[model samples]
Target: MSTAEAGRGPRLVPVRAADGRVGWSLVAANGRRLAAAVRSYRSDRELASGICELLAERAVLRFVLSQREDRLWIWTAHLPARSTRAGAGGGEAVARSARGYLRRDQCRQSVAAFRQGADHVQRLRRLAGGAFPSSAW
Candidate 1:
């Protein structure tokens, strides 16, 4: 069940892998996972700071949806490179959908939900086990 169905609101969850790598996942109100950090942080402190950085740059962050060679759709949120940096390519992807979608519309819906949840985030928590919330699966 989604968070809403489970009597919870959407929230950002900070997680730590068994290897001590940290990352964040955006969980939707319905309990579905929208997106997660593309790369893991070295520590919880770094994960927290990275989240702060993303929030500071959120206004300028860009969202893109694309199809993989496997024919699955995915979305990514990135920070565009400075225009003055001629050698720079596209911005680096910071977060991506937690899983691929079978259709473009499904991917777009996830992105839309991600935007809403992210903009109005009310709670942030780390699961007791430091893993993605089982409810999110």
Candidate 2:
């Protein structure tokens, strides 16, 4: 198993897409990517706001693990509804694993590792000009 899978905590790393849009990833201390934003943001301020929202809702967020038809297992994080009113099943997917796993056990382990470290996630400071050099899709 990799160091990240060994229960190491994760960090929030800024990433730049091919189109130059910026996003963020939850990466293990060993540099293994765990989860990432559902969509890219055009600016760091937007990215920071997104991160803040996620962090603020972390307590009520739910994590789900599923297997695709191709048999690849993956995990997704969802945000709960904002109100207790009827028809408020607002479980919107906000973050997902960076990659799919080959086995159900591995997928479960990834989820466990994520939960183990999510509460204490560290993030790098924003750079000047809002440019993140780490290339990610």
Candidate 3:
């Protein structure tokens, strides 16, 4: 088990690559990615959007992730519901739509890069969200 896995707290983190691209990932305490959740973006806004999508709420939606041949794929599934009818089999159903992403898009997250981006975003939020008093503003 990685340190991040053993460590407690938010499993997901935002990271920046050497090329200065930002990405989000689910990392372990050892700082290794749990899966290929890292996908880089040219700007922080794009990265934030991706993060939102990943963290977005789902109603009766469950996503299954799989890896094959150095690539990652996600398939959407929905919870089985009852129609107020008897003999209705309600179980996990596989989705027809499946999407695959390249492995290159998912690199192991670095603690340094993640901390840098996290700090920058948090600092921006504090300043822009009026965390300071009106007099300080």
In order of appearance, the predictions have TM-scores of: 0.76, 0.73, 0.36
Which candidate achieves the best TM-score against the true structure?
1
Q: Tens digits of per-residue lDDT for model 3 on 86-112?
A: 866563332212134454233212223
Predicted candidate 1 versus true structure: per-residue lDDT over 80-115, tens digit per residue: 675767788777788898999999999998888777
Which residue pairs of candidate 3 clash? 3-29, 3-30, 4-28, 4-29, 4-30, 5-28, 5-29
Better of 1 and 2 by TM-score: 1
Q: Which residue pairs does candidate 2 place in steric collision?
A: none
Clashing pairs in 1: 2-30, 2-31, 3-30, 3-31
TM-score of 3: 0.36
Q: After superposition, how far is residue 134 of candidate 2 from its true place, in Å?
A: 14
Candidate that beats the other on lDDT, 1 or 2, i.e. the better one: 1
